[model samples]
Target: MPDDFSWSDFIQRALPLAILGLALIGAPLLIFEPEGLPRMRSLSKELAQVRAENAELTRDVSKLRAEVRELRDDPAAVERIARGKLGLVRKSEVVFQFGKPR
Candidate 1:
């Protein structure tokens, strides 16, 4: 009811155009901008790191499996490991060591 304001004019003339402009702006944001922007790049970086770690873990698993197979089927490998790691020897053999001066 002020001198320059008209509620009837706003409802009849401005509201529909305002709604149309908002829809025009919002439609592209909802459709293309979401898919073509930040989330895809973030997910791509995460996927690359996961693939690299998966390859390293796969190689580790393969090596462990080969060692396990050898330990299961090879007695000579087990004896070599015991001799090197545990310092084991036959009852008649003696081990001698000499010390180095600092």
Candidate 2:
């Protein structure tokens, strides 16, 4: 209300409030800028990929554990693996070999 008031005085009083307002509005925009958004999206995609890989690894581990349990509890599994992988036959079984004609 004083007649001696000037524009500089008004500016001095309002500068702190102006800075506070700009900080409040700009901080979030700065954090969510174009570059920041893409970086966040990339990170989210990588996290999802890692989760999928972890799930696949977990399934593989479970399958291996089940195979181990089957081999420990059942002798048939070992025989099957030997016959299929190693081509082993019983002692009395006849083995035949076939060759392609030249």
Could you tell me every candidate's TM-score relative to the true structure?
0.61, 0.69
- Please give the distance, in angstroms, between residue 73's alpha carbon in candidate 1 and its true position after superposition: 0.9
- lDDT of every model, 2 decimals: 0.89, 0.95
The lDDT leader among the candidates is: 2
Model 2 TM-score on a 0 to 1 scale = 0.69
Q: Model 2: per-residue lDDT, tens digit, 1-102?
A: 789989998999999999999999998898799768778899999999999999999999999999999999999999999999999998999999999999
Candidate 2 residue pairs that clash:
none
Clashing pairs in 1: none
The sequence of per-residue lDDT tens digits that candidate 1 reaches over residues 4-68 is: 99888889998999999999998878656767656788889999999999999999999999999
By summed lDDT, the worst window of 10 consecutive residues in model 2 runs over 30-39
